[model samples]
Target: MAYKDSSKLLPPPSANDIISVANALNTLKDVKTTWIIGKISLTPGQQKFWFEACENCQKAINVDVGWVMRCPSCKEESRVVARTRVGIAVDDGTGSINTVIFGLDAEKLIPFTTLQFWEAHTR
Candidate 1:
């Protein structure tokens, strides 16, 4: 199979292209991509950053009921930490915003995962 370059498939930059945080925030589209340039800061006094999710479908489980949960999305009975979820503030000169990042992206800013962080601090 021929290895096609993906850069060829992208459209040329348009005037409406999201160039910064302010531009992205002003756009009406529900989803868009842009370079998030800013200093990262954790939300102060924040405790929990992750929740149990269905291993099969990767969705949050019903935690209020406790222990065993039948995942509505996957209909599975088991769940796992799956990954991390974090709330952070980013300021890119033009503006600032609070956003949630998860998985490997979240891991980049944090020194530890949810369980590891809690365990170390609690002990």
Candidate 2:
């Protein structure tokens, strides 16, 4: 029996693109917080904590849920942190972007230093 060569016909994959995709995928899987490319509309109350934004983007990045303290004066409840567990690539007017799937594992990873503000906020 003669065997046919199947590998020769396939196109070569770009290593850089593969790496980028892998990194994005890994980020989607590991991160537990979901943020969008938008401005912070609400002010932090007594129980509120502000997280630093990205240096380049200047957008509200990661939020510190743990830093949030209870306020006896305002009688406000702690803000619930939301996460993006699944992500799909979306096309904005300018270019492609990532849309987060809400209410998933992404909520759990909010407070870790390893999760940068910009990285957490941006798609």
Candidate 3:
């Protein structure tokens, strides 16, 4: 096939990278994050999908009921930010597997910030 714009074209699809749910379940460690085609299932029991992480050390703090937390990991009173943590299930023709999509990835997929998600869920 003759190509006009090669830069806009995707690399030729390879079966080596293209994986199914069956293959993912059996050989996940062997596969690289090259290609995946599946449906993202947002039906999970866990309602909350965010956590307060320390600003300095980026660790999960123990403090609750506030935005700022005294981090035990960093031994400092650092500001805590709600981080995205979405759980999703990917399903191809074969089967499905549960996966946690965290950080910026979750935020990009869900179309909402962690704070926004919490506010929306609460109401």
Candidate 4:
């Protein structure tokens, strides 16, 4: 007798299970905020800034500023400032949370790429 192949016959998630997972993901977003450290290189001529970042779990790591920009004329250094322009968290439909951020005028922020954010937030 031949055995049936059952590997592809897994049951779909139930509504209650889906809701539970959603609640858990929302809780993660509510309780955890990942702090990403990085340097921003400014191009004043082009009116743009490029950021290279390293993300850490805020609850697990120490805060450290990664880089500073110095004025060429005044010989003074200034901390690069970044504001959270937009933040949205939602379920990815795969039983996971997806958080997205955009810069001013909906410009894409490269440092917080989807993969990077997912990796940082998820185990």
Candidate 5:
């Protein structure tokens, strides 16, 4: 038996190419593309913008008392918070899809504190 190197058999696509949402969904999970940003939508009945988490482990905080939320997993109480749930409506002109954006990207698009976003959206 003989071994051959086939790593460079095919050239990868350009890293900056933008692809349609529909196409991206159908392709391999590893395929990357620069999708266009469109609209921001919070799903119905989702009123909270941030979720409380354990300060040490960053796990979800299920118990809340006044200003503190305690983590069940770590058994620690901390006021640390994290973005809850959010969806960004993205389109490449060919089609549109609701993609979940988190962390810094979500903050950039929303541009509001968790409490503010919650209050604004809820009303």
Candidate 6:
């Protein structure tokens, strides 16, 4: 399956020096750098990875009747206009990191849209 969206690709490891996931974690806390890791593992339970988030404040929205969602914090009501949020555990042999991908990043990472995946799997 293919997603129908243009995605900005993350820079290649060559452009950003490859580092161990352990080192990446430590340095990330102290400084900012484009550290890359090889052999990323998405882990399991990808079905739970994606969820709906409010478009206005980007917070998780509660689904309501008629395919509508209400944002608790922003108090905004939207009609099925939520974006995808993805959580994954990534490992590069050295260490593992749990990260959440949202917006365009989640769109880029997901090969298929949430609706498409659900429909395909439901049958």
| Predicted candidate 1 versus true structure: per-residue lDDT over 1-123, tens digit per residue | 011221333345665653677876876276544546677788776667665666555566645312566778767785454446788988888888787776556767778876675455446
lDDT of 4 at 80: 35
For each candidate, what is the lDDT?
Answer: 0.62, 0.34, 0.68, 0.34, 0.53, 0.59
Q: Over the stretch 1-123, how does candidate 5's per-residue lDDT look in tens digits?
A: 000111232234454654556677776377643444344456556556666555556555554412565556666666655544466566656666666554444566666765566456557
TM-score of each: 0.66, 0.20, 0.64, 0.20, 0.51, 0.56
Q: Candidate 6 at residue 67, lDDT?
A: 67
Give me the overall lDDT of model 2. Answer: 0.34
Instruction: Check candidate 4 and list the clashing pairs.
Output: none
lDDT of 1: 0.62
Task: Pick out the ten consecutive residues of candidate 3 with the lowest summed lDDT.
Answer: 1-10
Q: Write one digit per residue (lDDT tens) for candidate 4, span 61-122.
A: 12223445453433455443332223333433435443433333223544454334334534
lDDT of 3 by residue, 1-123 (tens): 112222233355678767787876777677533346799888579778887677666566655524676678768888876666788888887988787766666777887888886576657
Order of models, best lDDT first:
3, 1, 6, 5, 4, 2
**Which structure among the candidates has the greatest lDDT?**
3
Worst 10 residues of 6 by lDDT: 1-10
- What does each candidate score in C-alpha RMSD? 7.1, 18.4, 9.0, 17.9, 10.6, 5.7
Which wins on TM-score, candidate 4 or candidate 5?
A: 5
Q: List the residue pairs that clash in candidate 1.
A: none
lDDT of 2 by residue, 42-63 (tens): 2223221223323222223354
Q: What does the lDDT come to for candidate 4? A: 0.34
- For model 5, what is the error of residue 38's alpha carbon versus the real structure, in angstroms, after optimal superposition? 4.9
Model 3 TM-score, 2 decimals: 0.64
